[model samples]
Target: MRFCELTEQEFRDFSSTHELHSFFQTPEMAKSKQEDGCNCYYVGVKKDNKILCATLLIEYKGRLFKTFSSPRGYLIDFRNKELLNFFTNGLKKFISKKGGTILNIEPKILYKERDMNGDIVDGGFDNSDIYNNLIDLGYKHNGFYLELDLKKQVRWAYILDLKNKTEEQVFNEFKPNTRNIIRKAIKYGIYVRELSLDELDIFKQLVDSSGELKNFKSSPLKYYQKMYRTFKPLDQIKFMVAELDLNEYSLCLNKELEEYNQKISKLGSKSDSKKKEYQTQIDVLTQRLEDLSVKRKGGDKVILAGGMFILYGKEIAYIFSGTSTKFRNFQAQYLVQWEMIKHGIYNGYNTYDFYGISGDFSKDNKRHGLYEFKKSFGGNVIEYIGDFDLIISPLKYFLKKLISRFGGK
Candidate 1:
């Protein structure tokens, strides 16, 4: 087998059929990285002119030398020990030849099979051998962390399996409260529409507002524009925002209120519980109608929430998302999620990924709401093997580490 540089088409042809390929490992993502001043290259191992394994290396400038990362790592079978060794050696050589100090990789391999609550399944399939293989090959283990590191990959993820399931089945699997929220959004006449490229600023604003509320900084608008320029034409990215047409919703509420009044007037049965339930609903609707009148004075339409979806391989990932705090009662974010989940089911994808959750599952965890929200959709938690750093030059790598320790660029 020979390790060589691959053309864009060569890489695409091989990755299109590879079992481990994800959106991150694509040329489109490489182009997006290029927009950020990162150099991108594709390298792979081939035999008999057939490509076997590949990676997209993203090169970033380091303090003393160039550093690199292979996002989602190589497209190779981690279970194949021989192949893993070959790919690792080739990557190490490739980076060293480029005058790099350290190489970072986080493979798309699961470390252990886990259940819904982030617990290891009983005697479930595991990838401990691959972990050991990486260490034996001189790749320093980053260790399995149970909290968000900010600088490293959030190793844990949540994925809902959409295989062999109908859209109704998927919807029914959501928790009762989650289902209620979606229904509430529907009742509020919230609907999702795809955002055009020019409208990304609106998405940017919402996400930025949410970030500020949480004491975090959001990506600039151009970051999303660059992503659009790279992935939009390929139909691999989707940005959807939930909207409410107040005038139309007002009509719907008026009709519903009339029906409820008619039912109350024609009440013949003495079911006090049912009567109270209907009356309570009527009162709630009345209050909402009053609120709508005031809101409509400002605008007939309003955007409540939005999200970005990355469609690739057999999964649809709900990656970046945001919502307006003023419309929290509408819960339009849930509407966005439910609609996207149905989209995945309709498209015959294998999984719907609710990306990036803290590993701390405690109730007191500040981000516990994130975990709980994803959990309500009913899916297994995924734990990847984590990252590995291959030091190309020990001395240079040591200096770089020391510089980073002291907050030096």
Candidate 2:
């Protein structure tokens, strides 16, 4: 079979038809990455003009870098052992002709098995074994997906099973405090509504504000708009806003409750019987009302759960979520997750990634907050064995490595 590059339109058409295709390897993702600083290309293997396999290729210092939608990586689905030699040999010859260094690939076919909740429970395979096969083909094996499991590699990614679970049942499974926040948000008449392109400005404002607070970078408005344009038509993505008014009655109730609690706390120190009675009544009603409010608001309060969706066909939805800091005490974030899970289950997708997680899980790690939040959702942590590198030219590779090592302080 001959290999050829596929056009953006052809690639998107193919990808949209296959659920197994990862979002990263799609033409749309490649376009985004290109904007972020990478030269991307799309290639497909064809036999008798019928497409057999396709890959999105990125270039860095002459070597090829490939990734599928799951995340940036080397290859998406490099499991066609029969074509391994053909692809590797073709890649080497191509690199040599172009005076390049190497061709590096990390395929998406899991070396391990992952459960529905995105946890790697089984070590399906390991790098050493795969390396041996590559070695036989004169291809160097590089370590990738650092965390390996018999069935699943990393545990952080997950899919919410929505078949039998109702929205209420799913909400009930949340932590007590989280549920209470959703209830309070609802009691205040806070609502979560789908956003439109006209509302793009507000979404961008939220994204920009959030980026500053989190110290992370974001794509331009054009990119987000392009995303909506490309993915929304297919129902593979959506945008939404959760709002609350300051003058709402629940706002006043919240203030009153806070004051009442403060007074009870100060009086309780004296063990006054009258204060105790008032505290008891306040506690019961406050807790009950708060719970009711949370149930009504659903998952809109949670900032992180703002973006949620299931991959429809091969096109996956990128759910962008956020929350106001003013409502933190009520835990709107939890409801955000609950709603997304429900949405995913209803749509039925291959996997639902929580996006980036801390590379290191220690409390001090930058990703600690995200890691903690994703874990509570009850999904498995998946370590994609990490990234691996292969050098085509020993001298150039060594020189580049040396330069990188001592380039700066």
Candidate 3:
């Protein structure tokens, strides 16, 4: 096998058809990263002029030495130990020749096949061999992390498989409460629409607030702008916002209240259980109407939730999103998800990736809410093979880590 740098077209052609293809591994993403002041290049290992594996390498400068990262790296067969070793050796030499000291990698390979509840299937497919192969190739494992770590690529994800399933089938598989929330969002005039370029600031505001609450860094407006400029035209990225119009919502709510009252005042055969159900909904709707009145005093329309998505190849990735706390009870976020899920299903995509969640399944975990939100859409948890660092230049790698307080990975 021969390892060499590949042209953008060459990389794109091979990556688009790879079994492990993802948006992150695309030339478009590489160009987007370059726009963000990062250096990127395409590299591949070839046999008899046939591309066996390839990667889009992203380079970041540190205080001391430059660090190279292969975000969802090496579109290669992990089972091929020979190919992995050859690629690692060639990559290490190639990067070490430059000022690079560390080569960071986070493969998208699944670590274990886990159920919806996050428990490993007793005899499910395991990739410990792949992890071991990587470790054996002189890459240092970052260990299994349970809590949310936004600094690195996601080591865990939630994916809804839409293949060979009708839209109704997929919708019915969602948790009952989840479906109810989605329906409630729609009934309340919460609608999802793609955001225009000028509308990113509105999404940025929500991201800032959500980041603060979750204790993670949020992308700046420029980052979104650059990404939009680079990927939007290629039909690879989408920004969606959920909106609420108080006037229409109020009309709908009033009609719903009248219907409930009519049912409660039926002349005969009223069960206590049915009455209690009607009363519960009436009380909730009344409070929402009151809140709507207050919000209407401020404005007729409001953005309740915003999200950024990566639409590439066979998948639609819900990459980043935020929601307005004031409309938390309205469950606008649920509608935002349903919007994209339906899009993915109708567009012939095979997967809807609800990206990033805490690996810790414990209810007491602070990040458990993220897991629950993703889980409610009826998808299994994916614990990915986590981050690994290949020390290209040991001395500079340690020096850079020391200066950054070990944040280089």
Candidate 4:
């Protein structure tokens, strides 16, 4: 086995035959950073004509650092112990010759479940998973330092699944009252439409509402517009809206009120139980209807889907939705999600991902509310092995520490 540096086109061609993640970790990104005076390199190891592994390295403060980003450093070095050793040795020599003090690596791989429980499983030369390869390579392990697992890692924007199931399956997925409200919404002519680029002002309204409530960080509208144009050709993205009808809202409200009145007037036997249930239903329905009433002018109040998502492949579709304060009671946000999920399923996506449920699910945790909302959808929560780092050099390690504390540009 041997290791060497690859040019941009060379890496891209190599990646076409391997995983896409390898291409992301190509030397080119590092080289681009280097042109700005940051040292960067792309290195790969091969055996018998097979590219076994690749990594990206950047030089900062005379020390080599590993970025190990997605689709780039998505290292699957697990099965190739001989190649990993060769690669690591090559990295040491390459950086050292350039006056680099150390090499740091952060593999885009997760630690196994039991590995987290403090069991140091032996990594063998014959191991297949790259996570185990890191262990065998004499890389230090810090169990507590971790990030979300890959399976559950949510991209900023995504799609959801709604296929192969009956409408009842869709309805059953929501909170009971939520299901009825959407049905009621339909009865009142509440409709959903795909938003177009020219109609962005309407989408902005929804973005602002969501940003405020979630304290979400976002690029400006120009950023989204650019994205809309850039990824549009891929056809993996779309913007959707849920529009309300105030006239329908009012009618639904009146109809429910009439039903409640008749039940009370008839002295329907078991009147107390019936009245309590009916009254609760009426209160919920009325609140939603009243909320919809505000949008009655006919132009339509829109609830926008949160982001640009990639769904050209893979089974899971992720989402980043937010709601307007004005439409909170109307459950417009819920309806929007319901529609998105249905969209995913209909389009052949298996999972409708509500990304980023907090790892800490205890009641006191800040993310508990989000955790619960995602849980309500009935998918089993999967926890991924978190991120891990590899120390490239001892001297540079302390140097970075010094730079962090004492300050260095």
Candidate 5:
């Protein structure tokens, strides 16, 4: 087999049809990274005029030596040891000649099957051979990480398999609480709609608010703007926002209040017990009306949550999301996710990926709440094989690590 550089179209044609294709491996993603100061290369192995293995490697120039990364890539059959070895050997040589110190890869292959509760499945498919093969081929195995820190790609994700399933079937699979929350969100007049590019600030504000509340930093508005510009033309990305129609909610509440008033009027001469029950109903409705009045006084519509999704090949990935703390009880975030899931099902996508969750499942873990929330949607927790580094220049790689550790002090 001969390794060669492929044109953008040529690489896209092959990768899009491959079962292991990810949005991160696309030419558009490469172009976006290029704008961010990385040099992108699309390389493939061909034999008998057919592409075998392919990857989109990005070269990041550092002060000491350059580093290469293949994000969730190397679209290949890991089970085929000979083919993988050939690709790695050629890739290492290619990067070494280009003055790269290390080549990092975080393949999309699963380490082991994990259930929704984050427990390993007994007798499930294991890719220990693939893991061993990389180590044997001279790549260093980064330790399995349960935290979401210090990793290129997230080590864990939640995926809802929508294959051959109807929307109702998928909805029914959700936990009872999740379904109730979605229902409540809808009942509260929360609706989701696609945001045009001009309206991206709404999403940015939501993310910024969430970041501040959670004490995490969010990317600048221009970053999302860049992504939208990059992927929107291909219909490969969407930004959706969940909003509450306060006017409509208020109208509904007023109508309910009118019905309660009529019931009380009709019970003018009823028994004292019946009168008390009607009074109690009226009181509850009146409180709800007052709350609705207060909320609607601000504006006719208020954004409660928003999310950005990436669509590529067969999967729709929920890449980023945030919710308004003020409407937490209404559960607008749940509604946003349900909308995306329904979109995937109606559009015939194979999977809805609730991307990125800390692998640490213990309740004490800071991100455990996120894990539970995603798990409530009834999907498998995927633990990937994690990151591996192919050292091309040992001295350069060592020096870089040494400087990084000591800050060159």
Candidate 6:
């Protein structure tokens, strides 16, 4: 029932085996954040020489006060009320001693049971007790949010369970349209490959284009490069891109066009109805050929879509993704995701997380398109408990909020 600082190895050993472990709690991630100018601390609660709870606290120094955040952390069994209370009280005191004015946590526990469409499941497993415990322990609950705003971590995500399942089993779970789109990408000769470090520029460009199209700002190239360098060596990260092999696709289209032409020629001697049918087929094939030719004339290969994924514990998280507007119909994004899912299955991961989505499932919500796309993959929508702030210095916390509200300098 006491809390103390833990060495990196001690923290990693506990976190790696914890059910709620995430890559954000890893030493490498902490090191990367440290390099980005945040101070990282690993603390654990223990008794009888066994750890019960742990977290990676990131110290952010503001101009006036310091704040701490445990990104998707506070690795503890939330159901244990006593343990939760002890950790909260101990953590507040510890952070206060270090001059921290605020402690923010976004635990990776589910808030409630949610169906695939982001609707709550009635009479399902509820974590209200756990939520109440945190609030009762003096932690201020941040309101449940649906939009992708300034929260340290996303509130909603889509996760596909891959444990004890075959590739066909998982593929069968996808919606019919989703399956068709993946097949279409393959038929169109969309090639997916793992990108090397030197090729991250391709991913950066894809992400930048996506941000521009979505009207959101993207991280600079250096951020992704650092992440790759930090986690790639441990075989914990994968950067994948889908490309259209224009020449090969063009050849396939040309071959199909020739076969259709041959059929049309043979149908000339048959009934007019048969001839008309073959002519219609020819027209479609001919137009597709023309389109392929135009595309091939530009380049042999064109990047269509790319995504970055992180493999930690039992989950492979699809952290970031982007697609090319020019080849939107080609459905390269579907192929990219299929490749990652297959990779996860091959690697024996238990889950494939389509990481973040807007909690607002209403059609009018601007980001609802994201939720729909992830839903098509047949994953359940998950809502986390969201962020909680444990104020260490009420004066500083109040002043900061006041300043933020009035846009103070």
Q: Specify the poorest-scoring 10-residue window by lDDT in model 4.
A: 152-161
Model 4 off-target regions past 4 Å? 1-43, 46-50, 54-72, 75-77, 87-132, 138-192, 197-207, 261-299, 304-308, 392-397, 406-409
Give the clash count for model 6: 0
Q: What is the C-alpha lDDT of each candidate?
A: 0.87, 0.55, 0.88, 0.55, 0.88, 0.88
Q: Residue by residue across 1-409, what tens digits does model 1's lDDT show?
A: 9989999999988887888889989999888988888899999989999888998999998556799998888888776778878887888888888888888998988889999888889999899998988888889998788876656766888999999899889889899999999997787678999999999998998798688777777889998888877888978999999999998889888888888877877775777777888899899889989988888877899999999899998889988888887776777888899999898888889999998888778899998888899999999789989999988889888888788898875
Model 2 C-alpha lDDT per residue in residues 1-409, reported as the tens digit of each score: 8767778887777765553566556666676667666677666666787666666766644233222222333242344567765656655555555555655554443445555334446655554455455567765544443222223223234333344555676566555665676676677555566677666665676666566667756557786777776556556566665665434545556776787788887785686886877778688658746754764565433222244343555223334545444344445556555555656656554344664453455677665776667656544554443333445666766666665586621
TM-score of the candidate numbered 4?
A: 0.68
Error of 2 at 336 (Å): 3.0
Compute the lDDT of residue 210 as modeled in candidate 6.
86
What is the C-alpha lDDT profile of model 4 across 183-274, one tens digit per residue?
Answer: 76677656777667887566667777877886765446665565455445546456667776555657767887888878776866666887
Go through the candidates in order and give the clash count of each: 0, 58, 0, 14, 0, 0
Each candidate structure's TM-score, on Cα atoms with residue i matched to residue i, is: 0.94, 0.69, 0.93, 0.68, 0.93, 0.94
Candidate 6: TM-score? 0.94
Kindly list the per-residue Cα lDDT of model 5 for residues 1-409, writing each as its tens digit: 9988988988999989988899999999998998899999999899987889999999988776799999998899988889998999889889988999999999988999999888999998898999998898898989898888633698999999998899899989999999999987787688999999899999999888888888988888888988999999999999999998887777776787788778878888877787788779878878877776677767889999999999999899998888777766666889999999999999999999998999888899999888888988898999999999999998987788888998751
Model 6 residue 90 CA deviation in Å: 1.6
Task: Report the C-alpha displacement of residue 127, candidate 5, in angstroms.
Answer: 0.8
> For residues 1-409, could you state the per-residue lDDT of candidate 6 as single tens digits?
7899999999999999998899999999898998899999999899998999999999998777799999987899988889988888889889999999899998888989999988899998778887898898898999998887634588989999999888999999999999999987888788899999999998999888888888877788899999999999899999999998887787777787788788778777778887787778778878877777677766789999999999988899999998877676777888899999998888899999998988888899998888888889897999998899999999888888888787752
The candidate with the higher TM-score, 3 or 4, is: 3
Query: 1-409 in candidate 3: lDDT tens per residue?
Result: 8999999999999999999888889888888888778899899899999999999999987555688999998899998999999999989888987779889898989999999888999999999999999888889999998766778888888899998778899999999999999888887778999998898998998888777776768888998988888888888889999999889899998999999989899934659899999989999889878877789877889988889999988899998898877766676888999999999989999999999888888899898888899999998988998989999998886677677774644
Pairs of colliding residues, candidate 3: none
Best by TM-score: 6
- Ranked by lDDT, the better of candidates 2 and 5 is 5
Q: Model 1 RMSD to the real structure?
A: 2.1
| Residue 301 Cα positional deviation in candidate 4, in Å, after optimal superposition | 2.6
